[model samples]
Target: MILKTILSGKHYQFKSVKDVMAKANEEKSGDTLAGIAAHNMQERVAAKVVLSQLTLNDVYEHPAVDYDHDEVTRMIIDDLDPLVFRQIKGWTFEQLREWLLATTTTNDIIHYLSQGLTSEMIAGVCKLMTNLDLITAAKKIINEKTANTTIGRPGTFSSRLQPNHPTDNLRGIMASTMEGLSMGIGDAVIGLNPVNDTVSGVTAILNTFNEFVTRWQVPTQTCVLAHVTTQMQAIEDGAPAGLIFQSIAGSQKANTAFGIDQHLIAQANQLGKQALQNKGQNVMYFETGQGSELSSDANFGADQVTMEARCYGFARHFDPFIVNTVVGFIGPEYLYDAKQVTRAGLEDHFMGKLSGLAMGCDVCYTNHMKADQNDIENLALLLANAGCTYIMGVPQADDVMLNYQSTGFQETATIRELLNLHPIPEFETWMEKIGISQNGRLTSKAGDASIFMEKESM
Candidate 1:
């Protein structure tokens, strides 16, 4: 009972704290919402969190004054440890790159052979980790750029129109670099196009699979993606033909391919069996960050980072995404994203990562407005990491195809008809390898996933 109450209290307190922070961010009061951290949790955690990637400029900690001080400094430092450590703006990708550059740059290679730290001493390598130089370099770049352009978003890597947008490109390079780190198994990714709330954007992408295989002169593989249990049954009740799967909320097992949101499933089961009674094959896809609204006005769909970080667990129950909106194009009207012509969302930032994972999807697929070149790069990393072997993006007339060949996992399909017009050389290279006919298709052979089940046997 104590534990439950503690958890409940934490949730309640956290919500209240977040609300205060949000208010401060909009600049409605004398205290910035981030400063509201001072009100919610420990001073240290509050300090660090408020100054995260989303609000880097908003934090005003004077290290020289605070750290060099006496008792007060120690008190402040002690509290901020946990919160500041969770970096919001520059995240895992940049941090990992900084670590690599620090330890093994071209200049450092010679030193390694001579007297640099060795694996034996590496046990406590955190002691050697320092990014003062990296920080300087990043700052130097920031300084060189014009003053008006936006850099990164307060909450994500999404860039604003600041003239100092050098950080915008860094996100792509870092994303591509980090692609090598992925273990490449048990992926749960989503593909979304600007919905304008029309489910057809999603349906169109789904229908493309058949055309792809037919053009390739291979048999088509079908899959079902649904959220509601009854929706699953209703679609299946008609006894649909093809690969049908359900994407539930809470229960997710990659091999099982039937886990879904516990809450939604309960709603369906409680509503009666007849709620949806279709029988074919379907998988449930649930959103981790979404609350009651499956569709948001932001039109910017899911959380890409949260998806990649927990892909294994999510696929065990649900694919990471579904049909939704993208940011950037967010406005009152559900008009298409003019910037990303083909579809609406999917690219760098957290959203891009999910799209990247979608490139490797079997049970999930993606569609978005026409994306920019940079967005393409970010999403590509996710696809490559997911072991996608083929692509469906491009036009039937194009001489080349875009393909992401996963060594042993799943394959991805792209939307070729929309992609062919946008000329990206790398994108083209992918096309040539994959062979894009509006109807081309591919799949990933399931690598051994029995290891995840070892605990069950025990």
Candidate 2:
């Protein structure tokens, strides 16, 4: 029998998990692809099978699957981890919902799910929950997990200096870096999205960052955001590769457009790891967004949210130092307005955290988008409360090189102060030691300005 589901206004048909696996393999064959494909397929299959067996009364009255008591118990005992099974083996859906809501950390939830808590079980519990309950549960999970977890290096809140210039001029790059540093930013990593993707161009950018870091003795690392191949070449050419950067999308066509396939991505991860053995820093930086698959005309009928999740699964393979969802930068075709953009930001953060990624949100929009600073402000606050890892620190929320608006250094400060969040531990310590910041507040000293200006003159 064929089961049909509507996603992203498109109809998808599946005979079984086998059919889905076959299609996934035909498109892109890999362990990560197969794993995500199986999980999605099983979730859909379980939803149909479990929901069909339940009656309205059984759903509302007992808040449990409408199967025979013995059979349901047997399934739970057989599938779930012994600890989790003991907790919910004989419990109704109401009980399960209570337990899940009481669960604070995503790590524990992930462990349970990994131990075989099926998606059907989750769906059943969700059916009995109110929106408030779901939201509350989500908040608890994000807050607990993100508060304790550290990525790249240990820190509470981290941010990056994305100083890009269209012309790839050293002066322009130095100006942006100095501006960000003056504002006490760049804790996560100082990275540049190069206008030039070739080996020579990328090498120059990396060498420039290395020189700056060495001259000023900055605590943070730097990255020249180019294709993996170009980055590898720069490393071979004696340039510092502080981080390996790439843009990733969900579908094969989209990945190819970014000059990546699963094989290349794996190879890049391996290369980054090998290089970082001597440097002793986290090796990979990845950027992703919703609507990219559709933007590339390769979504393959999945909704933007699901496609984004699949990209996370793809990114997780590398255990990246940072995975940023460029939420509103994709434009209005997919996410039309502020509400959609805000929701996507929160959803991406939640999804990334659940998947064990060090997630950051680029609270940003474009000139053509139906969004503004207010939209970015609201989303940034929400992400902060959600325990987001980092944000993009551009100048005045405007990326001159990329032609997009994002959270600037001042905005990051506003959120940090509002939430009492600090930068990553090492960089924060450096900031304090250098007198650039004191008591978690930026000094914006006159001497620093003179220093940068003096360097610029030379």
Candidate 3:
């Protein structure tokens, strides 16, 4: 008797095939043991009965044995966990396959799988599915998980104020923000990628935005994209800590460079909860991308996709309000072209949503990439279909500060119009009140410039 062991995070050992069969039967019996026994018997008898009749190639190319639909169904029913079989017993294989392909909610698939399908079994079946079928199934899971575990208020579309500028130039920042606001954007939070990382620099940017809010009376929050430590200091110094922004990577060393770890993130979250006046508002904003671990030389031998998922896991611990994956921003070294960009965007969104993060996509690309505006547009639409929480609303799809072309105000309008999505409830009200957006239709007035300039002197 040969001992066979299956080791996972822990270990399970069986003294012999009979022991394994007995254990399986004890847990829940079906064809599992009987099928194995029969297969073993057939293998042993193959040499004696068919050895003289067939060549090596024929044996290798053909199945060991053929089973009709009834036989196959019987074998599956026997091996399946009793609960799973019961759930699926009434449906034929074709019907079951079709139902899985057509199902739009992940909860249904998860419910079925939980009935008794193992991960290995699921993966094996997935190998036979087309890419579209696989993506549809993944989207269902993401949708269900996102619906249940989202951080911020649920049931509304959100957008961020990514007003980036060189030198933290207030004029450029304000102009870009006004452009977005003119088109009725900036619902998530008005966040800035500061040129300076100092406490004073961050404080100045936050103060400028605070003054803007006071003067304009826009329903929004503010953030200066600095390290959490600096932002925390600004908060201590009485700056409005609307949202704490940080860039995160998969590995500890990479995160350390950003002055963050799980402990620091928790501390910052608590600080944000105390500092910000809004009750029940999510205050953490995290930025992650596909190649950040590899670019930081901290991948630790994992592939980029796995590393990206790990970053999402790290961000989820903080119950963040927003997690944006800067897809395609890292250039072609990581993700080569349009296809790579689209897949990475979908995968990142899917993984983040599954892990219960409020997932958004910066449907963007650098100038040096092999991709173009059409690629960005295609990716944006796909993400919208997948129910992405938000997207970067840069001016004319260009960010001078980051030197990348991302989704613009026009794309935002197009997406909303096409999908009939509205902004978050509060911002939607503000837009409707101000006549910028009415009844889900966005309109711009000629005096929009005067509104900002009239208050500029204040």
Candidate 4:
């Protein structure tokens, strides 16, 4: 509906609601690669004009993927609150954006509003928002969830201490973990991207992290990022897991490509809830990224932004402890450069928060992307200001195992100081007790991994 707009004596037309959504999206290489992007900037603006006038009912009527054919679409549609949808179905996208930014609209209001929204509605409103609008609105919402420790509390920034070793060496992994913990990182999680995805290998790493955590009384979670099935098996075998990790996409087909389905993920959710020792109300950790659907041939003619928004829609169903978008890890073919990557990072964080999920970001880039560490660092700072739940803390901003650059332990510590933010309250207490940090600032003992060695030889 309302897919035609005339701007500057030029006629622009979109074939469908999905077409309008794709063209209205900001410039991203991924949408272009999918052959769905606007041909020119003028057309892009015209598409936004058309999108602004479209009603919520119009978008809701046209799910990006057919409801019957796709379980993701079905879930998004079926789960919508009929009462809330009726209250706002007549509202235009422009109105939605304005209401979201209105001073009278509080965080609780948006959380209530989210129940009625489908992924298309979220992506449509996002297209009409500026970067500052995303930041301003997202800052109003803080979705805190607990998994042993709470995240997303205002004035507290968190990081996942990713001590990944290429060979899954327990010694090297623990060394990186100790260094990160020493600098007051790992409050969010001390997670690893294991080179070995085997159940036994993952279990061993989980045990190692448990031992270290138990020894030091770290008030954080430990996760081993592996396949959901692998993690489920490990959990079933009594492995020490704080959070169950999985990479999810926006579409059923893409998730199938990842060897996952809603049923399987639901099973893992149930398993983690029952098996893990510190299983909090939220026991799942999900990672998503733009272009993943396209890469797997599962976008179904929707734009990457819409697909990415759908990811949050799916993740929220599980009450995840944290759901992060690996923004730039897909490479230049998708995000292209720092600007696009930054935009995507902000958008994903905003969308996740709007969906009522505790959102984090792996503010990261690969070597081939037209981005560097500085660009990622800037994005991380912006995200932190947006009240992002957490970010990854790899060693020196480089992931030797994942082959990407992310925020480092130093960056997490520095951001906390710059923003006058502290880690989780329980974690900060532990940090102070061990002399790694003092009164929200890093102590002289910070950054020394050998401090952990004072107890026993590893």
Worst 10 residues of 3 by lDDT: 25-34
Candidate 2 segments exceeding 4 Å error: 1-100, 103-106, 109-155, 277-281, 444-448, 451-458
Candidate topping lDDT: 4
List runs of model 1 lying over 4 Å from the truth: 1-220, 224-235, 238-374, 377-458
Q: Which tens-of-lDDT digit does each residue in 1-458 have in candidate 4?
A: 66898998988878999999999999999999999999999999999999999999999999888888898888899889999999999999999999999999998889899899998899999999999999999999979898898899999999989999999999999989988888888998888998988999999999999988988888999999999999998889889999999999889999999999999989989988888777367899999999999999999999999999999888988998999999999999999999999999999999999999999999999999888888988999999999898999889888998888898888888898999998999999988888877877888889988889886522
Q: Say which candidate scores most in TM-score.
A: 4
TM-score of every candidate: 0.29, 0.73, 0.71, 0.98
Q: Relative to the unseen true structure, what is the C-alpha lDDT of residue 386 in candidate 2, on a scale of 0 to 100?
A: 68
Off by over 4 Å in 3: 1-155, 455-458
1-458 per-residue lDDT for model 1 (tens digits):
01011222343222332232222121111122113213433432332232222221112222111235322223223433244334422232224234434443332232222122111111111111222332222211110100111111111111100001122232332222112111121112212112122233224433443343234322122322333443344433442213223332111222124333334443443332332222311222322321111122110121121112222222322222221222222221221233321111221112212221121121111233333344444433333332222222211111111121112221122222223221122222332343331222222311222322223321
Error of 3 at 457 (Å): 14
Error of 4 at 179 (Å): 0.3
Residues 282-330, candidate 2: write the lDDT tens digits: 4778898877877676655444655576576566656677889999887
Q: Which order, best to worst by lDDT?
A: 4, 2, 3, 1
Candidate 4: where is the Cα deviation over 4 Å? 456-458
**Every model: Cα RMSD to truth:** 19.6, 9.8, 13.9, 1.3
- Model 3: residue 200 alpha-carbon error in angstroms: 1.5
